[model samples]
Target: MKIKRRAMLESTGLNMTPMIDVVFQLIVFLMLATDFTNTEIERVYLPKADAAQADDHPDKTRLMANIIHRISTESDCPQLKYKNGVLLQPCQIENHWKIVVRGEEIKTQERLEELLTIEGNLDREVPGNPKTPSNKPVMIRADGSAPFHLITRVLEAAGKALVWKLEIGAEKPPE
Candidate 1:
């Protein structure tokens, strides 16, 4: 007796439906998880002046202060500390910087004074050589939403403290 053979067929195409689904899911997840709150700060409209490029190089003993608008039940405007470009946690700077206001309102004037005091204290403690003006440069990284008035006040206070160099940390505007 002769046996008959059956031919089998094989599929050459790959199933990409599952892979595409996984990729789309990952994209959606990342988009939802990313935080974009700070993007507005980079879009601040800074006043234009004929002023030359200010020295941005931090002094050997540079002091950085990060000013941001914080929300609280008592005060909404609080001057927070920025150390080495990082925002410090609450009550982090026990001796260096302190919040002087309470309440939800922003106290632009008082914040300036407090910042100036901190600069003065730092200058006195960390003496710079005569070659470097104000041995300790005061750098301010204000939140994008913070009013220009607040920044101006801080600059004024810095001037009073004999701080010739004032650097504002900002991102380059998009082209």
Candidate 2:
């Protein structure tokens, strides 16, 4: 008995409409899920400065310290506290201040020390020559209405942490 075999059939072109639809859906989902706000620091009307400059190169690595007012709680709001030491719980009263380092509040001077020490020890050495890392610019974003004492405390804490280079975030006045 002889078996008959048919030749391979020519295939139609692929349809990219479904794939494009999926891609678009994924893009929309990601855009919605990802937050564009700078969550590291809360929104505040920054004080105006004549010499205030936008950070031209925003990709540089640096530690951000935020001095923000206390959260106001209304009718048992949710809160977040994790191993990273971040606290997002509502405060008993508004206008309370906090010093946060790497998403965690600065409870003590030692926490700041630990953060700096870890950053310094992270892949920054040149082979066998372990030298003091150049001062990492510590950016401080404080509310314009934030008390002057709070700013001073943050500065003093930064000094204690041995971070010399500092950048204070401010808004430019309207022309």
The candidate that achieves the highest TM-score relative to the unseen native structure: 2
Candidate 2 lDDT over residue span 27-67, tens digit each: 99999999755556665545668799878775345677777
lDDT on C-alpha atoms for all candidate structures: 0.51, 0.63
lDDT of 2 at 7: 31
Q: Report the Cα lDDT for residue 175, model 2.
A: 90
Model 2: weakest 10-residue lDDT segment is 77-86
List the candidate 2 regions with Cα displacement exceeding 4 Å. Answer: 1-38, 75-95, 120-133
TM-score of decoy 2: 0.57
Question: What TM-score fits each model?
Answer: 0.38, 0.57
